[model samples]
Target: EPEVTQTPSHQVTQMGQEVILRCVPISNHLYFYWYRQILGQKVEFLVSFYNNEISEKSEIFDDQFSVERPDGSNFTLKIRSTKLEDSAMYFCASSLTPGGEGEQYFGPGTRLTVT
Candidate 1:
């Protein structure tokens, strides 16, 4: 059984700093996405990457946010700058698009704390 994995399960940073969250999904999965959940708020979609390019993105994915697959196995999400409001739980998910009805598998998630 394969699953998505993330590093630095917890991170604490100060405002104006930069942070890069890492994730590794099942090798065969075709679609990857990043989402964030603010404390007591709904989960918000940030971005989705497929075929080495962004397939879909939400308004929340501003210029400060970027994602990349540096190798065949690793996917990364980099936040150029951290803001106090950025504190949240960031999740990485992947799915196998067998017939376009893909059910995503999510990682444990990285909790970001900004002060």
Candidate 2:
């Protein structure tokens, strides 16, 4: 089946450095999002992107964070400065629409380990 794919399944970064994680959405899906999952914790929504702009973002998406779909298919999340607290598995997801009966599809996720 068609599915979203993320690159470099795992990343180890030093604190205070920038990191960019990449994802490719499922073909034909529209709304895209970024979510974070801390070890043994719930998946938390970080930001939602649609129509080339950010539709919604959580408090965790502060000044140091940003997302972009530079190309029609690939989506990327960038952290200006990595922090220890930012270590987590980051997932990329997409749905046919912003909201409705359509289900969301998620990528395998990029495990970011900041130290």
Candidate 3:
């Protein structure tokens, strides 16, 4: 099976700033998603994209968060502004199907540190 890959394994930024986290999902997968896990907390869904458009998003994914498939092989998550509370590990995921049961394959993750 193919897997997701993410770059910059770790990212550190100042509060109120912006950051872009990158990922490359399995080439044949049709669905992509972004999820975050604050230190010591459960993983939380941020958004999902399909067919070059957003399929669903969580409340935590406010106007500040945006996702796009810039090209055939790259998917990205942009946080318009950073907040201290946003410090967490951001995981990029992909699925052969919708997020059903345990079907999503995740990347190693990029740890975001907002100061």
Candidate 4:
């Protein structure tokens, strides 16, 4: 079965640098989302995109963050400027909205560490 794949598995960056995390969502899926967990916190939704525009976004998706479908299969998240609080496990997810239950399938995640 096809699955979402994330790169680097782990990343380390300086507080003021930029970082681009990569993901390949399930081949046949449509809805894509990014969520983060700050070590022991709940999974917080960052943004959701569909039909080439953002469908919904949370307050955490500030000016420093962006998402894109760079190609047919690759989805990426870029943090323009990192901060120490930005460190977290960035998860890329996708799901089929079969009746709107929204059971998303998540990638292993890219653990971002800012120093």
Candidate 5:
């Protein structure tokens, strides 16, 4: 079966540098999203993208963050400038639709550590 794949399971970056987290979502899915979890916090939605535009986004998706589908199979999240508080597990997810009960499949997650 196909699954979401993430790269660089762990990354340590300086507080002012840029970082790009990569993910390959399940093939044939139409919706994609990014979520983050602080060490002991709940998963928080960042942004949802579909049809090449943002469908919905949370307050957490500020100007420092951007996402792109660089190709047919690769989805990437770029943080222009990192901050210490940006440390967290970033998860990539995909679903068939954005509905009340849409089930999203998640990647293993990329643990980002900023210092």
Candidate 6:
């Protein structure tokens, strides 16, 4: 089966800096999402994107966070200003349909370490 892939599996950045994590989801999927796990916490939804617009976002997806599809095959999550609490394992997920009804496939993850 095809799988989602992410670049720079590990990232370290200083507080207040900007970072962009990149992902390439399965070619045929339609819905994409960004989620994060803070240390030992449960996975938290950050944002969801579909058809070039945001579908939904959680409280955690503040103005500092953004998602984009710069090209048909690439999806990205940008953190404009990193905070210590922003450190987490960021995951990229995709599905054939909206997440509530379809199975989402997740990438390995990009571990962000904000200092």
What lDDT does each candidate get?
0.93, 0.94, 0.95, 0.92, 0.94, 0.97
Backbone clash count for every predicted candidate, in the order shown: 0, 0, 0, 0, 0, 0
Error of 3 at 109 (Å): 0.4
What's the distance in Å from true for residue 48, model 3?
A: 0.6
User: What residue pairs clash in candidate 5, if any at all?
Assistant: none
Each candidate structure's TM-score, on Cα atoms with residue i matched to residue i, is: 0.95, 0.96, 0.96, 0.95, 0.97, 0.98
- Candidate 5 or 1, higher TM-score: 5
Question: Total clashes, candidate 1?
Answer: 0
User: On residues 60-99, what C-alpha lDDT tens digit does candidate 4 reach at each position?
Assistant: 9999999999888888999999999999999999887621
**Model 2 regions more than 4 Å off:** none
TM-score of 6: 0.98
Q: Give the TM-score of candidate 3.
A: 0.96
Candidate 1 wrong stretches, greater than 4 Å: 98-100
Provide the lowest-lDDT 10-residue window in model 4: 94-103
Cα error of candidate 2 at position 12, Å: 0.2
Candidate 5's residue-wise lDDT over 24-48, tens digit each?
9999999999999999999999999
Give a tens-digit lDDT track for model 1, residues 12-79: 99999999999998899999999999999998889999999999999999999999999999999999
Off by more than 4 A, model 3: none
What residue pairs are clashing in model 2?
A: none
**Candidate 4 global lDDT:** 0.92
Per-residue lDDT tens digits for candidate 2, residues 1-115, read: 9999998799999999999999999879889999999999999999999889999999999999999999878999999999999999999999997754688899999999999
Which residue pairs clash in candidate 4?
Answer: none
Which predicted model would earn the best TM-score? Answer: 6
As a whole number from 0 to 100, the lDDT of residue 93 in candidate 6 is 98
